[model samples]
Structures are given as C-alpha cells and as structure tokens.
Target: MKPVRFWVGLVLVALGVLGILDATGALETGGLLSGWWPASLVGLGIVAMLSQRRMSIGPAAVTVIGLILLAGTLDLAEGGLWWPALLAVAGFAVLAGLRREHSTRTPLVMFGGATTREQSRHLRHTDVSAIFGGSTLDLRQARIDEGATVDAFALFGGVKVLVPRGWRISLGGLPFMGGLEDKTDSTGDLPADAPVLAVNGTAIFGGVEVTNTPEK
Candidate 1:
C-alpha cells in the first residue's frame, strides 16, 4: 500500500479541484460530495490498516471506528454514539498489545541516560522508551534484516538513532509539542531491494532524531 500521506494529498487535491469547479459552475455536485467529506478519515484509516505487514488490532480498530464516525458525521448514524465505540477500540488496542507475540525487550531510560550498540548480524524488532531521560541506539555495526521496525517513545526526554549509510528508511508516528528529525544523508546509493528500517512511535514534549553514520 502507498503511504498515508500520498493518499491524503490526493484526496485533498481532488477536493480542491472539485471546489474550484463548483465555484466556476463548471460542475455540479449539488452538495452531495461536500456531505461525504468525512470519507477522508476513512481512507486514511484504511491506509494505516493495510500498511501493517502483520494483522494488528490497533489499526483494525482504528479503521472500524473511523468508518463509524464517518457515518455519524454524514448523518447516516447518531454522532453521540461515537464516544463509547472509541473507548472500546482503545481497550482493544491495549489488549492486543499485551497479547502480541513480538518481543517486548524494549530499552528504557527513566530519569537517566542509556546507550545501546548491538553487533548482531541481523537486527529484528526493538522498542525504546525514554522519560525524563535520554537514550541512544547505534546500528552502524549491525545489519538490519528485511522488515525491521524500531518503535521509539519519548516523554519529556530525547532519543537518538544512528543508522548506517546505504540503508533504506521509512518513518511514521506522531509528535505532539515535540519534534522528529531525519538527518540522514542521502548522498550514498542504496539498492531498490535494500532492507527496510521503519522508525515509528510517539514523542510528546520530547524529540526523536535519526541520523546516518559511517559503518564501523
């Protein structure tokens, strides 16, 4: 599936074009298209759901709840009923996280600092969390296996990831009152089928930075 931003941009562009045409009296949607504007949320939810390689309950719940809210917004259902459904979806995501088989060997730094440098041939999946502290993860000496994902969470703290050059990287996640930076250099050539390293998660009142480094 394509990136969520791509689909969202396409939707926004289409809406802008339609609005322009309507203003010029070149086309008539009769307000029908305007009434269905909430469909954009539904489209984004679908993109998020399909972007996951494994079936994740979080994305699935988001998709279903988004559709419900979209229906309510379109007057096809009661908008007042959305809250309870949203709460249920949140609970489902929590439960699914607990039941997931993936390793939970997350590196955590609380009120302190930590640095991790693994020499493993293949880095799989990892999670890093920092609260009122800082953490650095160096992967310059490690080989990333295909489909590797690194989930980083920072709250009133900071996290840094140093990746080797020539690695393909994709980023996702949310930043609120904080920032996420990709300072990786793109001067080196990378293969089309190079292993993928996905960096994602949340940064609240904190920051996460990913930078490329020379191989060690």
Candidate 2:
C-alpha cells in the first residue's frame, strides 16, 4: 500500500488544524504541544517501519533518537543523554555496515561526485553514501535471480539510482528535510516473485531518486 504520503499528509493537516484552533482560542494546544515537535520524527520513523516488509536500522535509529529528544523535552530524562546515545547508535551503525560484503563499496563521497555501475549477473547488495556531494548507482545491466538490496545515505547531497525496467523496485527509506523520488515504471504485470531490488536508506537535507529512464 502506498500510504507514506497519505500518512504524512494526514499528520500535517492535523497539525494545521490544531494551530488554527489555538489561534482562535478554541484550544489550549500551546501548553499541550509544547516541546512536542519531536513527535514528528517518531511518527515518520513509525511510518517508515510500516512501509517496509522487514525491520530496518534507519527507521529504528530515527525512532530512538526521537524518543530520546522527547524525553529530554518532557523533563523525563537528562538533556545530556541524547548526545551520548546518538553517538553510540551512530558507531554501531558504522561498524555493522563495515562487516557487510557488497558487489561494490561506493561509500563516502564528500564534496564531489561518484558513480558506480554494476553488471554482475548475480548481484546481491551494495551501498552508497553522499555527504555534501552527489552519487549515482546504475544497475540497469545487472541481472538479479532472486533479489538485491541497496543502502543509501545522503547528507546535504543527492543520490540517483538507475535501474532496468524489467526489475521490481521496493523503495523504503527516511527523508528528513529531503525527498525520495521514485521514477520507475510500474510493475503491475510482474509476477509475485519477480526479481526485486530493495532500496533503503536516509536522506537528510538531500534527495534519493530511483529512475528507470533508458540510457541514451
């Protein structure tokens, strides 16, 4: 189900209504919503989790971070706790990522641009990271027997993914002050077990786009 945008829109509308009510003196939302802005992060994290078939680190991290901030804001926990917790989580993620094997390791593009094109007949997994730069992953020539997964991270940068029209794309990720654009053709006629490519990651102040546009 394509419920990502639906839920996001619903939340925004609810917030707007609350604001209007507060402005009209119909509600004392200011007192209720004070320091509650971080709930948006928690909601987005939950939405991301629901969108995916399995658990993912990105959404889990987002949720945890949101909870930490909410606790601090509500005076339920020390404000100093968030920093150490964030660092620990980030360290764990980095170490975990290093242990995984991929067809290509195209991580860390800082202040530049990088492109990785994989033509493996049995492609399995790959990852991309763009920080203050841009990155592209072209899997148009790759053949997947069962499925493949791509982990993408874009911070103050952009990522573009090129895939073949024959493959089914499952896009799941979190976008914070950023966007995730899916330009792939529909797979309405594909079989239930058609070769799938699962793309997941986080875009912070950047964008991650998946396109099936044919090469010139």
Give the winner by TM-score. Answer: 2
Give the TM-scores of the predictions, in the order they appear: 0.52, 0.56
lDDT tens per residue, model 2, 74-111: 88666477677677678746654664554544455668
Query: How accurate locally is residue 77 in candidate 2, as Cα lDDT from 0 to 100?
Result: 63
Q: What's the CA RMSD for each of the models?
A: 8.8, 6.1
Give all candidates' CA lDDT scores.
0.69, 0.73
What is the clash tally of candidate 1?
0
Measured by TM-score, how close is model 2 to the native structure? Answer: 0.56
lDDT, candidate 1, 114-215, per-residue tens = 888856576787666677789888878878767688777676799888888878888767675788888898777888888888998556578988887622
Candidate 1 clash pair list: none
